[model samples]
Target: MTTKVFTIQPNKRLRAVEEIMKWAHVRHVPVVDERGRLVGIVSHRDLMGAAISTLQVRISEVERLQHNAAVEVRQLMHFPTATIGPDERVQRAAHLMRSLKIGCLPVLEDQHLVGIVTEADLLHIVEELPDASLALRI
Candidate 1:
């Protein structure tokens, strides 16, 4: 779980998201509302999909990028997002992610965004755990 999270407003431009993602080196960004509540979430996949959809026959790559920047974060984010509590177990989060086919989940506390847990974070935790081995009885 990453305690330091980067969030974006629903009205912010895509370019802002891209810049933050690039600077923070994060793939998933949570979208917050005016009250700092988790309203939606955006991933690199979502941005890529938006970018691909904007490709036109006569449009140049630069134009497509600019067009994407004009689009608001709310337009590209996935709403009604699934969130987890800070006290929830890691296994539960992992199961949710696997079943939902999501890369990460925002952690909320009392309806407020707190942290984020990603697949990579889970993998890292597993890697740090004690090794397991089988013992055979003859």
Candidate 2:
């Protein structure tokens, strides 16, 4: 189970997204509604993809256009989120991530965001566990 997740609102603009990514140094973030329900996820990949596409259309035009300085979180977020309950087994979380092709999940209790689990977090667990690096059966 994961907890202590970071999030943003949907409809946020890309420039604001950059600040959060830069300040937080996070690769991904969950999007949530006003009610705090999970909605979508935004990853560094998503931001970079958007940035690249924006540039590809017309590099000069993009360069001339200034991104919004006061963009809200909602303006630049992804939707249709993937989430899992906090009590679910770690294996279940792993399965959801694998099937969804996502690296993270917003842990929820009822409809509220609670914790977050990521692929790296899972790996860290293994690394911290007793003899987790070993390849042995007892």
Give the local distance difference test score of model 2: 0.72
Per-residue lDDT of candidate 2, residues 49-75 (tens digit): 556354456555445235444445565
Q: How displaced is residue 6 in candidate 1, in Å?
A: 0.4
Worst 10 residues of 1 by lDDT: 129-138
Best by lDDT: 1
Q: Which stretches of candidate 2 lie over 4 Å from their true place?
A: 53-65, 68-76, 136-138
How many angstroms is residue 67 displaced in model 1 relative to the true structure, after the best TM-score fit?
A: 0.6
Which sections of candidate 1 miss by over 4 Å? 53-58, 133-138
How many clashes does each candidate structure show, in the order listed?
0, 11
